[model samples]
Target: MTTKITWLGHSAFQVETAGKTILLDPFFTGNPAATVSADSVAADAILITHGHGDHIGDTVDIAKRTGALVVANFEIVTWLQGQGLENVHAMHIGGSHAFDFGTVKLTIAHHGSALPDNSYGGNPAGIILKTADGNIYFAGDTALFSDMQLIGDEDLEVAVLPIGDNFTMGPDDSVKATNFLSPRIVIPQHYNTWPLINQDTAAWETNINLQTSATPVVLQVGEHFDLS
Candidate 1:
């Protein structure tokens, strides 16, 4: 089996695997670094990592347009339901749910969760995808935490981590995180979207390469990585 992962800028990603199209943190409309528009995105399911405006970008509109199921925490699910959205799967940290293509486990993350409208967004989380081809870890907006070692048990094939500071883990902490998850390949996200979080990806890559065995795959806005 083969899986294709595309970076959509600012932590957003398009994962095509197991005959399903999955979108992670589909922020785009107002994303300064986004390469595609909200109208151009289509997916079988949408997975939201948190309730921040940047992470939940265009989720309601896109779900309404494509009828794609929205997967999120209970609080965020209820918020979306109030918006007249019916297709949603409410999940929580440490819980795993089975989908048509694979399993999605909501993992722990250190961050805030508040909807754009000031409603409760539940707890922030990272996503662990157990797919046919490999396991993928998408670390949403978060600071470095110790439990990441648990994710290593899955034998992570790829780990998509936020390298932007101020709001999330910067290069130093992110490198330490790699020591925990130990994925075969690591991809940097959530950087360069804003000046406050802007980073030198090349420096990050070099640091990781020197310190860890995992290869850092730095991608552009629309770049992709194909794995088996």
Candidate 2:
């Protein structure tokens, strides 16, 4: 079966595969483009890249309401557990864990993960999801790093990366990242959220097309795509 991915604005996304639905960085409750609130969204699994409010937004409420498994680093999992979230799966960078949907490998990310209350949230991470169809990478907030080539050396079909600067890599660096990762398809995220990270995504895609062989796929908020 093919995997379907939906962009929910900012760093939020919905990925469906093997009859299971997974959510990534679900920060849609107060998101300007948010179509549904945390209480309305349902997921079989929820993956968090870090513990920042924007990244971990509404996870506790959503997990409590939907009984979804919250997956993240050990500390974040512990914190969520303290919040009374029963189903929490903790994994560290370079570790792989098997779930009902598939296996997920936590890759390294150069970023911070302090919780809203300023508690340690564990090391930030990028997620590499291996499903029945193909492998996918979600490069949570990070800067340009050469190790991306090593991480992308799998059967990668799609990669979701941040092209928003100030908090992440800019368009130029993201183009280089695409060249290094060389995924079949690339989607830009974490941009146009606010003035600090605002960017011309179309322009970024055009630049990436000239710099890499990977096809850039820019999706509108609430838009969905099926990976072949």
Clash statistics: count for each candidate:
0, 0
lDDT of each: 0.93, 0.90
**How does candidate 1 score on lDDT?**
0.93
Per-residue lDDT of candidate 1, residues 1-228 (tens digit): 899999999989999988889999999988999989998898899999999999998899999999999999999999999998999999999999999978999999999999999888989999998898899999999999998888888899999999999999999999999999999999999999989989999899999999999999999999999988
User: In candidate 2, which residue ranges exceed 4 Å CA deviation?
Assistant: none
Best candidate per TM-score, number?
A: 1
- State the lDDT at 99 in candidate 1: 95
Q: Report residue 14 deviation for candidate 2 (angstroms).
A: 0.3
